[model samples]
Target: MQGSASSDFDSIPEVALSRIWQEGWLAPELRTTSGERVSVIYRGVWTHAHGPDFRDALVDIGGRIVSGAVELHRRSSDWRKHGHDADPAYDAVALHLVLCDDAHPPLRHRDGRPIPTVELVGFLSAPLDDLVARTGFVELGAIGHGACLPTLAGERELDVRAALREKGWERLFAKQLRFQQELSAFPPAEVLYRGFLDMLGLSANRQGMARLSELLPVTTVERTAADGGSKAVTALLLGCAGFLPLSPGEQALAGLTPAESAEVDQRWDVLRQHWRLRPLPSYSWTLDRVRPANHPVRRLAGFAGLVSGCAPDGLLARFSELLGEAPAAWETWLSSANPPFGSARKRQIQTNLFAPFAYAYAEVQGQHGLVDWVAALWEQLPGAVDDSVAKRTLRQIVGERRFPIRRALDEQGLHQIHHQGCAQLRCFECPIAELAMRYEQPVLYHVDEGIRQLQEEIGHEASHRLREG
Candidate 1:
């Protein structure tokens, strides 16, 4: 039943929309007894529709263009509510999109033919729902933290590593594309600077990072014309970010060097100019719970140092080269000390990882690397289990369920078999046996041949002890 007048179909969450499709709530126009189409977009595969400009579109299914969407919506009546019926703009609507078939009397195509409606619910099954329910959460923090623990067994490591690498690369490229897109209009150097700041800001503290990013550009513009001076650059960056209000301790250190002290004075004036031109917190950047290493200021300073030291074009290539090395090498590069600066100034630069590989990856790789890293970490450090028995039991239970276990588990489970007891002689409920034999045995009979032999030997030893007594 529909709720009060305020219930609007457009308000549905994207997750719910996807679920509706999964659940077969929307009927596809091209459905057979076999199955339904995965999705229906207005523009089909050939059409080059840009974001927010949903004019003529082609729809796709399984990577092929199935049809063209002249019109799309959460419900059929949306066509009329949005006044598409009267507007000539919607005359090309080829498919009607809806979450449910709740449209009145159905709708027709512009050619006096009946437009096929796609309801999303028909494909979703109960098992799929269970799987989704297990994974989806309104709050990310609420997701079970222990879900990744199965990857820790020796058998699972390679599987886990492979998954991490694949996903990580995806995140990296996606982020790189986005950075390129954002910087399409700016000069290469400015583009790189903006991207570096954005990577530093990231999703953790959006407002603070944005504020710093906007100011950095303005400062850069001023510094370029101000004779390419380091003093000017330093002053502009520090002052624009509102960090010019040096603490008394910082002031005392600055006073120790007359040249540095004068630069600080010039920086203070730039800071004043920055405040006058831009509204306070123009970027709306926030610093809530941000670590010193992750701070936007540290990242900006680091970027400033990098730009001051190296050519912009070479930075990304150098970063990629560094990342191609072993993880230990990367750690060393990141932890190395700054080239040289005043004691007080050196402290600021040293806060960020020296190599800036992570930040570079963030700018270039983006979510792909982040997600892959998280996945890899998950595999390396899986959570606790009751025992080998419990591990084997879980492997069997999961196997019997016939669900898609992640790739990490497939490798880890196989690896366990080479090292642990076999299924015949181990405990039924034990995970070790299940893992050793590839999840064939149930909880009741998870033993190995070695374990059976040991049991016989133990029985003889017990009988001898009894006879002696």
Candidate 2:
């Protein structure tokens, strides 16, 4: 893939390009491929989410100060290749940056608005190779190493742990408040169902998934399931989602066996007439690069399974009962789910959907006892530390050093810090920054001692795991 003149630019990697962008290594005055003058007021937050590489960036394009998302690629063609052309999330993209302007007809958003494209080669501050050499290979979308890391590195490890835990509690409270706000607008069950649907889509197809939830709400799904069964629920969802293939051949093309296809279509045939919700266009989904298991089809199937399994109990009541039960039981149930969602996805649903919703539901019902239970459950829940943002922020906060992310609280704290401080470029007001400032100078002895203690702690954990295994 790396050869020829354009291929040379291809070899530079998107991460390198992002680093250059973050470093502000572009020429003083930049111009798009169409010769429009472009000015960089703010590069935006490097949020590696579903849509743009950078969010809420400020740019001056031909004297107009435009505020929107910014997307970067090695080649302009990658914009379409990555399905951004169809994704509604990219509609807000104000600017597109690329090394090669290979895309014919220029770039346009999903809404057909023209996106200003900047080819970096002509706008570089130095030779491409030299600029790449200077920029190195920073992680794509990672915020820079925390300015507070050095001062915090020298403090007691206990202090650092306590700080993260405090931030974690703050994050939990924020989630609770957000859920409560939604509860005010909608019933608890519907709100929770909506949240589950949103979380199931992960980053890529979240918008489409949320839209699906709104169209086929909890009340509708429950009634449909009660009347027909899980098949009815699955059929209703897939039909609305635009995934129920029209014919046997299309079903085959979509990897559905004849029997499997027939069973769903049979139910869909009956349901479609009664529930005439407008189907989402296929383009609304980002289906190309997603793993098979995490495919929207399987996620919808899993959701249908949840509805049928819960039955007359309803989602909120069943999940609240699960919350009171052992955490292992919940994990086991999720693991053994009909579609079998992975631990990571399961943890995501638990952390983002169930826990916050449970807290909100309990508070609205004035179940004072359950409120305290949910708070305790949040503390003990394992964090989804594998999340890219969590991993990136961990490195930003701790540098090359290793720190155990033991609880969901720890992960949530990292997320809170990232959204509020690092991503916003407001390090001066960060809690870690304030903590670092409390100690005027680095304590060499404490830094060394902390490192030693961390090593011993990690070794002990490994040994304990080995014994258990």
Candidate 3:
């Protein structure tokens, strides 16, 4: 019993052996008394060596003393489970650690000799338990918090931004290609412009707007006719999707009863045929608790108005122009009561317009630039808002990972209401706060000057287009 207890102290589990290698614990060292003796013992039978595929084995404790090397796994049983016991590849295993002592089947070495095995339960239990306990509580949160600010400072931030930009550009170019493929067989300008609108709609109601667009066939109309033809298709689609209120004779066309108009149904059918629509996967449009101003129908109407006002070829230029103007000027345009598409909620409209631009910028310039842009924009948002709300909104806007901070800014101010109409949580300390700190002065000035320069460039470019015409 005393001799067995002395030998048990030196035994090691296969699982612990693998862990030792992975965690950098096992290094070749000498014991002074033993004069170059390795401390860790392994046991298995010797096999082949010196080739493209060489292997050996150190089976039981006595075998380890004879030949010193080991490959390990969670259990000695894995040897058979992984089929290494049968493969020529594992002929060189030097040690086998078993959780339970069992007579493993005899395996032949290259020279065709039976291999020995080691039992490690008593040797490994205490040390492995201590290791697991220590690692389980490692302070990851402290590390992340400590690194956050330094990560955003100086050239480190710039390098991150550059990597983000490259990734963003790749994503944008890929999307541009996909959009083109979606609208292929139509004119390039019509494809580009309508793709932009679809992206806008997708941003708002994802599945709903996509289903609505599929039903209306804006791209199909553009393909069959010319540029402006697609605008009519866009209106019809938006109108059917409840984005547009019935046009003057829409009720008559729909064959509605005294109370309700059938125009939506009839027009949906006609547009479907004209566009050669295919059946899309079914989805329900969400209107539950949605405000009238933020309604999909109203937003679609605004989109229609914008398309009607700017012909397809001029669409890009018009967008650049609007973006180049004062926020006040665009706000006034959006808020106009008698605008062609009818009145819309000013905030919703601004969000729909600005959100797409941010996505587009991120796609083109890279995520780091998007981070800067979002932070700059958030700094300019109304002051002292809820941080959580800002974070949620910004997440919807920019995305996660490449631009988590930007998404945080966009979520500000939105409140979730319970059945009893009570606000649940107060969220704040968003990306906007970060932006305010980072670019409060220089970014604002740059944006103001940049807008002025862009307006001039767009105006000059427009004159050139007119001359070409």
Scored by lDDT, the top model is 2
The whole-model lDDT of each prediction reads 0.42, 0.76, 0.40
**Candidate 2 on 143-194: residue-level lDDT in tens?**
2322346446445667777778888888888888999999999988899889
**lDDT, model 2, position 78:** 81
What ranges in model 1 sit over 4 Å off? 1-152, 183-185, 202-204, 218-228, 249-262, 268-299, 311-469
Better of 1 and 3 by TM-score: 1
Candidate 1 vs candidate 2, lDDT winner? 2
On the 0 to 100 scale, the lDDT of residue 414 in model 1 is 31
Question: What does candidate 1's lDDT look like per residue over 366-433, in tens digits?
Answer: 54665455344334322232235435544543333323433333333433431332332122222332
- Which residue pairs show backbone clashes in model 2? none
Q: Which rank order by lDDT, best down to worst?
A: 2, 1, 3
**Ranking of all predicted structures according to TM-score, beginning with the best and ending with the worst:** 2, 1, 3
Model 2 spans > 4 angstroms off: 1-147, 150-155, 246-257, 440-469
- Write down the RMSD of all candidates, one decimal each: 19.1, 15.4, 21.3
TM-score of each: 0.39, 0.62, 0.36
Runs in model 3 deviating more than 4 A are 1-204, 213-235, 238-270, 278-282, 312-314, 336-388, 391-469
